[model samples]
Target: MDTNAFRHTLTAFRAPRPGAAPSNTVHRSLAQRQRAAVSQPWLIGASLAGLMIAAPALAQGEAALPTISVSGSQYDADDVRPEGVTTATKTYMAPKDIPQTIDTLEVNKYKSYGINDLATMLDGVPGVNTNYDMRGEGVLIRGFSADSGDIYRDGIRESGQVRRSTANVERIEILKGPGSVLYGRGGGGGIINLVSKQARFDAKSSVTLRGGSWDNYGGTIDINKVVNPHVAVRLTADREQAHSFRSGIRNKNEMISPSILVDTRTGLRWAGQYTYDNVWRVPDRGPVYGELPASVSTHQGFAHPDDYVQDRLRVLRSDLSYDFNPAWSLRWLASKREASQDFDHVFGGTYCNTAGRTATGAACNYRGQLRQNYAWQATNNKTTTHTLDLTGRVDVAGMRHELLMGLEHSSEERQPQVYGTVPFGATINPHNPVWPAKPAQRPAATQNNLHEATSRALYVQDLIHLAPQWKLLVGARYDSYDFDTLNRLTNARRAASGDSVSPRAGLVWQPTAQHSIYTSYSKSYSPYGGRGMLGVSGAQDDEPRYSRQMEAGVKSDWLAGALSTQLAVYDLEHYNIRYQPDAVNFPNDWAVRGKERSRGVELSAAGRLAAAWYVRGGAGVMSAKVVEDRSAPANVGKYLINTALRNGNIFVRYAPQGHWYAELGVTHTSARWINAANTQRLPGYTRWDALVGWRTAPWTVTLALSNLLDKEYWRSTSMPGAPRSVLLSANYQF
Candidate 1:
């Protein structure tokens, strides 16, 4: 195939209109930009060095082009439309065909903007909010909290406490609404699925180094090799060490991932992957009571300089596929994941009351507004998960159907240990804190409790093409969860068991290949054994709580598939929420008589605007409220905590056929309540980011600035957004 013809086909859908500038002028301008780029001495030198390093490979006939295509359609290595998503139905389908709202962050988008972590990468997704927690980064999808257990890697559950690295990520898929039909025992908020880089038969290699403000520095290496026609291998690794903007806080992390694929001559394929990660950091809790005082410094943290938190993770995965015929295929996947975390730090507790001073209030100052630090609080947790899936596709009654059936089992054990606290002679004022010297002979922590949980699930889903312009999706899942808790201090043991079934249905109508309107309804459940925020246990007789959602959306492709846009409206309700009836007298007495609801409209657009312009952005308007609260009448009809009423983000980039490009972006979030009673609030804020880069074939350099206006704002309750910072990055491909 002629290469120019192939390029034209990709752009033909968005061809310039009549009466516009001649296409020849555009070609000439591109040529002029290339010539101008060549005049830059640094760019020329970098290009020459890259060519010299690749000369030997070219001489040996090992140098290959950046992308390869066969027939008239391009393959994975070259597709750039960003119209496909797999997490929604566990099958590759256009977003327009799916009946639910799903958002994706492609590797190119994040790489261009120099986003390095999962939290930052999710900035522009509609209805998604990010925050910080003592354990790890926290997220709220729709309106409910999604913890580490709610995150997945390659469709397998992974711990959320570990910091996520983007070095080995191919893309990030955000599945909105209820997902229990695929994943088991998760909140209704939704899930974040991280797709890892796969081994390519066409080999490629690259290395990148980055440095930024706060003494941040890191390096990543990605290498892929095709050993033979049947075997391919790929490896990715990265190391980062940095000091935080907060005083006495530092971070260090390392990750390595390797994958292999085997294709037999008999229409069978197999792949295997493994990843190891180790991370260490000093934990920081933002200002007291989620507020910054005039006398307090944003850069100061109450945690000791030596306090630290660490996480270690290991994962193994395998996949196999066989084609039985032109219309039939079978695929199976299995994975095992293990994770552990250890933390020791001082965190802000209750405000000291000097007037009511007693032995417990000895640390209080005369002001009675000081924050007493909880010292030597330590915890260790470990979890293991295993999963298996089998999927197939066939044609029945002149209709094509894709089916996925899976099984999952997970076991988790957590042991929390806290040492005796050492009282400080001087009270640490919230507005002004005085550093305290390290104490000698720190006490050893004894096991406080052992909590263990085991879960098993079976699920199946089918996508059926009912007609040329209509599609139907149906699915269900059954889960069995069991938990056991043993209190060492009280010598008490308790166990609980529960089961639940979740269901989903959707219908889609396509008036044209570029436009689709769809509606869907789904249900999700969370057993007591699942991550509980209220310290409730599964030992009770109460069954698992459930959530239901109804959503309708329209998806359209514009500019000949160069751009994709989506508009969706949804109503979600969560029931059987646990609440304390009387916190002052019966703090531990809880009842499941609470209900929450979220109604929202979301709009999103992504992909290319023109040959030289690229854009990705979204906006959301949501109203989350406590619908019913029999246990806490004061919170009835109140807005949900941390659920913003409006949020949006947009990024625009201009990159012609030259060695230089520039980008500008903005993110905005509306004010939100910080408590169930809606008494405290977090003000709204907007942040800006900019990027400039120059590239020549295998070498590229970039400068990225975050918080361009240096806005001082809170991202969550007390978590302040990072101040203005700059990052410089360089990449070389071989």
Candidate 2:
């Protein structure tokens, strides 16, 4: 035979056939191949890192490991879904594995969408809305809402209590539905968890400078270091200054976040974090309109009406954990936070025709000049929380089980004082006043010096497997809260305490590898002391309320876990609620204990379906009604839709190595209505975002532009939505 033919025949004979190799040999060979494939991407990533290193280090900084994990929930690469776990508790886990509805936006997604603030980033989550106040920000999930400080950071409660920037966040996890079982009192419609960044094996550094419309300018620098093998530290800071497009509006903000994490090879870990925020703003209070629509324009003198407020906040946290074995671990955490704000505002009649006057005249002008200002009105608050969590996997009665048990205690104190002053200038003529002659006035002053609250809770849960395709979950929790408020201005005090034993039961069945069906029953509670205002006698009090939620859903995962779809139906009822006249302020003497119910169906999908194609969508249909309201009729139910589509290019080189990367995506959200009246409808909106990024080695850049169309519609609450904006960010590794 010829030499070529002889070699071909030998190769054919050496080719292995099915079932020809031993099981151990096959396993070893597969492991070796996976190792080689995983190692190749770093080599290429190294070259990219080298190119980015050439960029000058513009300011003060340090260095760190090349790789960092921003997905949160302490998960490894192969199990990226840990952040998805949800069970009406403070515990963190992957979203997909959790029995409840949970979603996440990691650092990559945040950077790609130009969402550096928690308020802006959370607006995209389904059934979640934003409320922008003169002093701070708020969020509503599943129709339940809270102010800034309700968010959690790494299972430890911090005092973000009001609107605070998300400058140090590594990832954001949003849990939909009620979650009061383990988080003490405040999880009416679920909770939002902000995961902080930690030092990794690959040391790295980064600096980003961004500028946009309305004279917006800002910068951020992040540094990380892996000191030796067991200790790592990271630091990040940001500063932003901007002018609003609305006439006479401006804002400035600065934030710094630093964290240190220590872990010993012997399985003991400790971590500490600190955050500081300073913000100032001058914005429009509210525009007035009569029966008829009006057209007005102003960018000049009196048109430059101004109102402003200043705020500052500080937060600190520490955590420690130890592992007894691969299946068992214990953790403890401590935290403290402080925040304050000051306000000054002036509203003047612009250069426009009065309601009854045909011309702009001093007397005919309907401009009832009300110059009210609050001076140095401070709201000081502090909270210290202690948490202990136990998580482990064990075998019970010839079956596998997952267990979570924890204890938490929190004490919070709030001191608020409101003082108002008249106009800054002295008044001239009572009839015809000069522009600069308006005298400042001192209005009334009131203070709440002793607004204190405390909560203690203990919760335990178990996930038991009964068969290959079935699992049952049982959980219970006990919570007790004490609330007290004393008004210095009135010398009045009211206090209350209540406790409850909440239980949950659920069943999950996975008949096939592609499908999971589950049904869960959960209980939640609420208190009626939100606004902090007592009427008539000027007393403070807290009233107790309760709720129960029953939910059933089926989830499907396709394309080898890349695509996920879920359909769920839920019925929730709230009873013993002290219905106040309104949400803003209530008379301390009046209490309306009533009942309300909300039932709905929800559908959602996420992840990639085909190569380079990704989709995320959600739709909700529900009826929320007040069953026992003497002052009002049953309100109509509103419909909502939240859907987005993402199509982009993929980095093929990373796939075989068990890595994933995307370059750009087109994301869009459907319109949603706020009230059942439907007369007040917010237009649907869309935007574009991109992600061509890497976390390790040299440097990586990600750029995002929100509201590409500059649509000035409302996304949540009573605030106008954001306009077209751009964010350019970059990170480097050393």
Candidate 3:
């Protein structure tokens, strides 16, 4: 039967109440049954029976059809819409049906373009700024700084360091806006979930070797095997090394992953995986505004050759699931991660003494060396998480519902120790060059601290199909947060605990088979000790800080689903923040109470424009400002730091059923203020990149070029951008 006939048939059914009637009461008139269905507090048998016969052939049929591969599908957006596993809602859903903006990045597809780093790979994403500096490799999403808290892997929060190794990642899912319902500590502006590769029944393996300019070289290997019908195993590993365009810098990276899976293919499944990554590079702190002399260029460096930053991470996870039937399932996830970071760098401000005076035994001209000092830090992070959820589909009073209920607990521990030298110990001449052989004196330990934080939350979400073309989504999460910090240097202790409730609501309307319009509002919270350096108590520190986001968007497919588009406008705000920095004398300190908000519009597209032409990319425009500041009223109107007013990037590729293909891409960002006071402006830039490749049945070779113009710009306010570079690579698939 058609949809209307099915819905009409549903109206004439009602289940008996617990104690009011017998089981045969459903044999009644249509009007009476409809009245009973609406008046009763609960729905049971009859409506569910009617839904079972219609659900598989109707709703799930058209709305959840399996993905199909067309021409150019291997390297295009053919699978961007499927999601495979939904990170936004933790439930099965169509990209259009969810009332949020989610962008999927296929790692292999971008690998073909010779982009491996997480920051560079996200250049095409809207509302994101790939502004990674030397101190850390975090980016800005929707005008907010995102670090380890907003990045995850395989449904687990990989604390200490964020997701940066793309070699083992199969796909990256970006969910915009607040995501506190499922992730208690995340989604203030958005969250990125890295999906790793797993063992497959199909025996597939590949090897890739590459080398290019500046002594860059790397190779990767992947092997998969199926020992039996119910068991599979896989191993993946990669290593890369490169010399920097900047002086006194070098880089090396390595990653290895192994996984095993036991799948009955119907009822029960289990999977276990482990990943290890080790990276080393010399950190660079580029020129400071108005602090550097005129002769300085992007290639010049003052850091000692011994300066370096190193990070090592090891993670293990186990996942198990049982499908009771086709409509219901239960899943559990557990993970443990250990990450360590060590860095030694030199930083300084002015060349001369403050007030333009000299203090050395032999007084000299005002021109002097840039006063600098050494800073070293070693941090160890340990994280653990456990999550359990039950998901299923049911019918209530003739309306279909997809439900998710879950509970999760996350804990993190960080041991940080800092060392710094006496001022002027690592000075360097600005005009002339005289390098000191390391610091004459060894730096002394400054601060040693240990921190621990934990969050426990229970969440529930329901998607109700109100009608054939309308849907309503509602969810809420309650979290209990606790934190403690001890300073080994001063023998000081600080502790805090609090609780919060985060809520989400959305409405979706499908006007046609190819288009969906939706609006959503969500809330997220910062748990105790959730910000930088954890939390330092203030008047408002007793309560958990909160953030909220309101968004409206449209998702559509064109050209018979070959092309997909997303347009979204959003208003996001963080409360109990925007306090003056001097109030706490530290960064990321949320003291007093104030407000900061960001309003923006974003548009994105991915698809095959023609038979051989594929296009992808988007743009974002935002107006972000401090609405209120309790400590400094004068700063109330200032814009946020390092956030551009307009940013966009696009990549286009042309490939046929032949042996050759080519791609050209561009990235643009508008001028932006480096400081929150709206001063220290940095010039914007546009960069162009191109690639050409030739492929055979089992071998593919490519040449990639970056920054054709070699224009000089800053990656962030604190770091200069890289110059033009090239890479050549070969891939063998078997």
In terms of TM-score, the best-performing candidate is 3
Q: How far off is model 1, as Cα RMSD?
A: 10.2
- By TM-score, the better pick of 1 and 2 is 1
Worst 10 residues of 1 by lDDT: 59-68
Q: Rank the candidates by TM-score, best first.
A: 3, 1, 2
Q: Give per-residue CA lDDT, model 1, range 599-696, as digits (tens).
A: 99999986678887877789999998989988778888999887889988988878776677788899998988877888777888899999888776
lDDT of 2 by residue, 113-175 (tens): 445556666654555655455555566566555453346655444442345667666556676
Give TM-scores for every candidate, taking all chains together and pairing residue i with residue i. 0.84, 0.75, 0.85
Stretches of model 1 off by over 4 angstroms after superposition: 1-83, 111-114, 289-292, 349-364, 375-388, 418-425, 429-433, 441-447, 533-542, 579-590
Model 3, stretches more than 4 Å misplaced? 1-85, 112-114, 161-163, 352-368, 420-426, 430-434, 439-442, 533-540, 578-591
CA lDDT, candidate 2, residue 587? 53
> By the lDDT metric, which is better: model 1 or model 3?
3
Model 3, 90-158: lDDT tens digits are 653456778989887767666754566787777647888767655455577887766647776654665
Q: Is candidate 2 or candidate 3 better by TM-score?
A: 3
C-alpha local distance difference test of each model: 0.65, 0.51, 0.66
lDDT for 397 (candidate 2)? 81
